[model samples]
Target: MKFYFFNAPAPASLEVFRQEYVSQNLKKLRLAAYLAMSVSCGIIMLPLVFPVLNQTRHATFYRGLNISLIFSSALALGFEHVLTKGTRKQPPYWVGQLLCLGFAFAFICSCLGITFIAQSNPKNTLTMYLLGLGTVAFLWDFDYLETLVLVALTSLAFTLVVQLSFLSPEQALLNHCMSFVILVCFYFLSRIMYSYRANHFLQLKEIEEKNLEIQKMSQAKSEILGVVAHDLRSPFNNIEMITSLLQKKNLTPEQEQQYLGLILTSCQTSRNTINELLYLAREEQLEAIPLERLDICELLQQVQQEWQSQLQGSKDLKLLHPPAPLYAQLNKDRFHRIMDNLLSNAVKFTPANGKILIRVREEKKKLQLEVTDEGIGIPERIRPLLFERFSKARRRGLQGEKSTGLGLSICRQLVEQHGGSIDVESEERKGTTFHITLPAVK
Candidate 1:
């Protein structure tokens, strides 16, 4: 469904092929159609002016030809309007392409039809009119095949006109040569524009892609400075409090060890968060740090156990898995954060008597893990950007606790780095399910 004018990438679908092939240069296409009509009108009517300006033999015939050209242009213009409306109102894709080509076809017919209405003598009027329409074609975004077809149509039209009309041998040969030169001119003209448009579309697409990246980078900066500020500041406060305690002269040995351990854990946690922020700053992707084989079902079991203690007054939380361990290669720490984020959201949202299920399965060589919670689901308005970085994460938990939006966003990055994907299904007031897919080890 693609033709090489200057050789660009093929369209992804038939409709896409129609769009790129036809509408990419829509403005030029419109201009060509209008120009062809406007000038053809003048050429057709020029014979009527010849009677007043100079000697004219076939006065009645020229007048009739002029009237026909005017009528044809009007009819073609009407088709143009219908095609334009049909294209916009969601008609079939082919309809627009065909109508656009209809303009060219009308131009060819009228150009030849004029010959039958002209004086039976040698004059370059027909040649000029045909060539004028051809010139208009050059301004359009026709592919090489389209241009070749147009050239053939013009050649055939001129041949018919020559055989049917009265012309000297000299004039006939001259028109043929002129037509050859003009067709070649259309060839090079179409090629130049074809390449220009390809490059033009390519650069525009790249700019759009880069613009998205820049927006993400901007959002990451705001997150690091605004959302992560609390996480960073809380750890620093813990370190300061431990430092203050250390300054007391008579602290017991066990107490001192516990304080030091608390300080170490806080510092490590802060360091991990800072590392993720730095990774976001320096590169677009989080480098997949070395991974070890871990049993995913055991991982979920540990997560459920941790949540049981964390959510003491909460609803029933269950882990469902097969007897055989499902293993995958993953960075343990990052994997823990991914599961913990999803689990924490489920725990935070579920009511005291509601149910939550973390299920795991294997399908088509991929591992599927889904966390389903019967709690207040995501709002319809905010669902689209749930995993977008820098999007406000202001949803209230069952207990009215607010969340920092960065968790799900970070989880997405971590999952992608592991060659996995995450998604959520939710309905207002019904519940939410977070789904994860990853390559599984045999």
Candidate 2:
């Protein structure tokens, strides 16, 4: 199959997605509540218009009540539709609050007007008005103690109006008590639901803010690493070249050998440090390079040739590969770095006469590579964090080799960049195997 770079758009930021979800949910909930209120009110007030429930009623009062409720319900539906559009510019919070309050007040007024027009027994009329007002107030701002107090006062006023105007003593007292009780229960239930929804929205908002902060910090860190690495490379390159030149100059035979060895070792150490810094810099500045199909067998052979002298000196060194050629789409430079780090690690940690094996194979559309070594395997606790940058998993090699604790991290980054994964299986004093898997090109 042919490989191509597909530049998919970056996913939406967490904050944006979260905000949209919450807005949609709240809009749905409010719309449902408004619809229920409108339908229930309309059904309950039907008797006032039909004249079956009462005959001593004013036509103007009944007409006004019905018209107000119809308009309020229509306005509520319009607001809900506007909310559902998901436009960037939302109506102001105060405007929305006013709209909700206006609808609720109109609904309450309609219930009271209908009650007064239909009933001669003031007990029932006052009960209807108090219950409507209390419900509307609680729904408008359920968590406010002041609103609950207003509901209580309205209930008490209703009781007075019933007793003074038309209710029998016993009936007025009983209806008043029941209305107040109902108001209290509705207020508490509405308050609880409101609190829960508010807290849920707050928690989601906090998480979104944290995610944004983390993304910003990651970007800043990557940029800083890139800058520092770029600045360090030039001086180190000059130093390595100067050291090489000095090593080749004429000198006393005894002194020449000692000086040459010192210069070469210094250059090597500098070169290794430079390589580590470069890897880190690149990781910060770039996403994974797009993969290109190449022969892994050829790449490994070339790497082995580069490190031939070092591998030849170790009598126990063993390199193994499948007889058939293996091909993969990978970033070549990154792949080489990963392999070199693992091989060098094995050589350093393995004792004399201890074997090291580099093995490769294909398994079910995946390419697997394993580097096994009869070396002092990593400690159990240390293994988990082995691939973390600058992790404190330091150990002296058999030959006392120095390390910067960066190789494994670089290896991990490179493997992941190719849409692959790496893992280790090790037993102390037995062996360690670094296993890597990549998607195979069809």
Candidate 3:
């Protein structure tokens, strides 16, 4: 059997997919700020390590370092806002990459200059540069392998820088090793956090989709139940009426024949109504059979033949179509019910001498079948709920017959189940039209 995808859009582009990544980044912004605060605290304690804090030159050096930390923190806050805004209209990926690289370089230069002015020593510069490289690597969109490489390289670079700084190589090496261990821990912690947030967001989306599907299923079930209750009652009522009439005694041969005919017709109506209900129940229970290719034109013609006896006494019941055959991928039983419902409604509503036209045509990979009737059209107030279950509209015909009000609702459900749509247009006291559009078989 052939299958067709529903109306959902195709998979989104990478930029759109990156929007989810940005949401995860928002949570990290708070942690990043905390890290910045800790770094600022370290910068403030640097003066305690120096013996000449009372000197004007040393005091100015400490003040500059404090100012730089505050400036970096403020810039970091602005970057947090940019991430939160979540706008896709930002510059291309390459532009964002360049901008981030530029910021990293500027921050590295600032840290190096501060260190140089304070001690006039280039020995500890490599330690600061390694830390800067770690921060820069964190900001880049690096894969897992790249991140591991960056962490290892930064650790090695920091170890070398510290070893060259002091007279005692052993103490310097121990300190550098400790700092490298901390950097590695922070890197892994960030990676774990990112993974957790991504999984959580996906879980939330899946729950939402399931909830929506449940709601649709519940609604469809309710509609089917309501329609079945109403449609089933009508035939039972007719059976009661026919039995009541048959109880009369001393009837002529012609009267008996008429009563017998009425009984037969009522039984057939009852059977057809039950079949429609069964179809609706099956669909609601999620037992909808697969669709297959069927000749729609032949299907409609057969439906017309089934109702030929009823329409024979009426006037101007016409089937209009081109000679070419039209085929569609649909459930034959369900499509038959749809056509039967439409035709029955048309015949019941249209007056004697009024026209009922059935037309099937093809348009660009779709099959369009329409049934138009010159009948007492639907009222505007009732039209809104015309396809709703148990919604009885104003019924007027040549003999003023009533309706079960389930036919249109069943037709709509059947059409939708076949991956098609049905619509109605009517003008009160003028005419009514029902149009069904189905996907043409490939």
Candidate 4:
């Protein structure tokens, strides 16, 4: 709709459409020029072939005109070939315009020349002129203004030629009227053709974009299915095998307890995997999340206390924030989940007595939250995949704890859904710091 115009095309669209139109029509123009050259050659030889046409009063003049047409057509053909050599991309605007105008004028001149030589046969001359005009209109793709200019010039040329050659004033006047009417019809025909081509081009572009989108969706679906199948299979197999072992008569009480423990762990793993898959699915659906203004400093302190107690003094958890309340629009439960995942990772990686810090502040009218830990930092090689689902960077924690490889991914999804960004800074064996930035409530 933006591209559609009642009178003229928009400046940008016009340039693009013009380039395409010109590129496509260039070959046709070249072929037409070649045909013109060949026809002129034949006409030049007509006197020799028929022998009787040589005796006509204007025979010399006709031969001279045909010679000129042949020369001009050959020149045009050579110029076109040289201009278009190795031009695979769209030619420049001026070049295309020059080509179109050059061919147009050449055709017009040839038509008028023929009419002048064949004055005695006025009807046949007029028919040839009309055919030439129709071919010119149909072959070139021109806008309304260009078409109008070309048609007007053609009409004037036709009328002038008829006035100079015809003996009867009445017949000449009739020819002028017919030329005017015919040129008008050609103008509309040319416009209709241009519009059809434009519409067809736009339709092709739209279909291409839709096809690309569909391909991306299909690829993502395949990836999600692959990850789900791979992650779920191991746990399910462990549970099944453990249950079978427990049912065996040779198993002692200790073995039975150990097998039951293995089954329980497998079940827990399966449940965690399912929960993560649900998180990814929910994020993909983009369900609306409710938000409320809350003091972020107070919330961080509460989270610090919760994680600190869980650490039980094996690791020191600290909270640093501004004295004043800094408010932000946040979904409380999702925000809590983000903090829990970060803190859980921090605790799991940080060795005994290593410290964890939760920092909250306002920067440039935005809420900034950072979670830094004195733990083995991520490897440079794996950092790129750290936030990806089913990440290859996933490994056991310092305490030999398991990882679902989905916590950071879910945190990123939740933060982005709240119109925020999450990023990490880390150096191997030094430490890691995560920064979360969100819009602040003033």
Candidate 5:
């Protein structure tokens, strides 16, 4: 049963749309109320200019009805004003309904008063009622059912009043038929108004959702740029330092060769970083990485050798792992990124000649790895936020090395995405250790 008479929203969005619809219509409601007030005031002043009321025996009663109409309109306006004074949240649904129905009642009362005064001129009376019906149609928003109720009540009230009070039977019958026809015409008009308003709200809602999605994408772009800039800085700095060292005149052939090798390693690292950034930017959600069952101890040994070579004897890098190979399901590249970030942090903070240890073991179906460095330890206050992006805990290294603070955060994200967890332990000035736990392949 698909009835198009009511332009209703989907059920999931219905409640939200209702609130927004009411909020948006508040100004229109106020304007319609003002128009009702103006009409009432105009009719109230008519007795002063025209002597028609003086000829009527019920002048006092007619005067009273016009005054009551003005009062009701003002009351409705004041109530709406009070409700919408300082808030953006829409009032309850009944509140909007009450305002609409009240204003409709006021408009009908004004029509009745005018009809009574112009009864002697049947043509004028019919014209006044038709205009009133049209005004009700254009002034407010209501779905088909409410409009039907409004039209039915208005027509019946007009028919009963005309037949009982002023007109002869035949004249009243003619008036009744004409008013019903006018109301039926306006019923369709009211539906068009309702449909347009509802459709416009839906368009605006769609635009709003699109704007939110665009904002999220823009934010993601900024984050990727920040990450690329941060990670590339260290390797680029290493290349610059090694190149400067190689340029000095007092160096031995061995020293020059070592410095050139260091520069080459730094360049390779920078290229790897750029490749990783490209892969991340292309895959925003970091879709599943192809995993392999491999010996965890062998991977750690390879990383240890790489770092030992990069350190160039400045730090004593040692590995302590079980003699037997421990296996885990791992994404090789992502696992390398985690180790790189952790070791980079250790090397930066650890003073020259300090000891850095990589410990790996398997216990109770879990593989555990730890990197402990005798560096300037993390402050207690900083430990909690150490893994947060752009953390305030980031500080200069022992040799005044700069930090972007995003490394640890990236490490934690990579570890968690691989079904592993990372934690840190540190004390100011003594040492710091990072621990990682991953499921072991039995």
Candidate 6:
């Protein structure tokens, strides 16, 4: 009793979504055109079919009917050509309307053609087969109202032909029933087509979005490589220069040690840079590292002791936490690497007399860790890219220690492996605080 109509107009995003999928629609239209041509080819050769069947008596009438049907098929196929004339672009708003009308008109002629053949050969099963083919092709891309129109016009054409066809009343009744059957089959088949088009378009949209995302990531990767290449050139030059200095014929022991130390430092810096690049390049491997329950207090204690020995008690490094065994699911070695880089950065940036704070607590059923440094903090402009590879956040420590601009990025990657995230807060000349949050376990 009730029926819906043309798909409700979508949101602006879906309108844009539709624009992206013009190629798929155009391909469907081309295939439909070919299908129409196939039907027309058979109809155009109907005179030969009559002669082969030894029915030359009515071959003239069937030939004329087939000619009209062929013209209609040609016209319908011509409309489909509009989509293929040039490079694929967004289809016009009326493309669906025009295409459906074309198919509908062709279908009307096809039904009349079938009526004539069936009336001439009352027991011809070919009428049923042709009706099925024309209905499917006509309603392939039709909406509810459009489908209703197709069926009505086709039924009207079939009825008019039957009345003028001069077949017996019994034959007319049988063909009328067959018409009803074809219309019902077309109605449900068109509904299925509606679902098919929607899903097909949705898949294209997703693939397009993923391709765009991969393209953006590829561009970013290239930029990072360029920065890495530029960064590597200097330290490698330093190492080569220092290697040459070590080869002097005569040199003092202290002087020799100093040059050797410089070479070692250069090698270490280059190694760290390459390690960061490899980690970023192969992030998928990080997912395989399994996590285990880790004691937060013990880890922070180890970090403090390590830094205590490294900085030689020159700066105040404090570990702040509540007196509890705060446990969390974490990969210990990876987490240690995260803390190592953060503390190394804290020590490098904080002035000798400045303070560094490592705080851990439970917040919202998650473990929260913050590394606060009271030294040259990040500039507001650079803070956004602080964790990005080869970021503009690169800065010399208070002691003029070289920065690879890779430490925070490595820390973030390691944290993410444990199903957590890292963030930072800072103000120039005042201090910077880096926060790491992970899901806490009881």
- Per-model TM-score, in order, reads 0.70, 0.51, 0.59, 0.64, 0.60, 0.59
Residue 178, model 1: lDDT of 70
Q: How many pairs of residues collide in each model?
A: 0, 0, 0, 0, 0, 0
lDDT of 4 at 32: 85
Give the alpha-carbon lDDT of every model. Answer: 0.71, 0.66, 0.64, 0.80, 0.77, 0.73
Cα lDDT of candidate 4 equals: 0.80
Per lDDT, the best of the predicted structures is 4
Model 5: clashing residue pairs?
none
Model with the higher TM-score, candidate 2 or 5: 5
Count clashing pairs, candidate 5: 0
Model 3 poorest ten-residue lDDT run: 1-10
Question: What CA root-mean-square deviation does each model show from the true structure?
Answer: 5.8, 16.1, 8.3, 6.1, 8.5, 10.2
**Per-residue CA lDDT of candidate 1, range 72-103, in tens?**
65665576566566555543555555555555
User: What's the distance in Å from true for residue 100, model 4?
Assistant: 2.4
Q: Which stretches of candidate 2 lie over 4 Å from their true place?
A: 1-267
Residue 408 lDDT, candidate 4, scale 0-100: 92
How good is model 4 by TM-score? 0.64
TM-score quality measure for candidate 6: 0.59
lDDT of 6: 0.73
Per-residue alpha-carbon lDDT of candidate 5 for residues 154-187, written as tens digits (9 for 90 to 100) = 8767866676566777877787777777777888
Q: Which ten residues in a row have the lowest lDDT in candidate 4?
A: 1-10
Tens digit per residue, CA lDDT, model 2, 227-285: 34653454466567656666675756786666567667656766776677666877867
Candidate 6 lDDT by residue in tens digits, 342-436: 98888888888789999999999999999999988888888889888667778888777877777888788888888899999998889889999
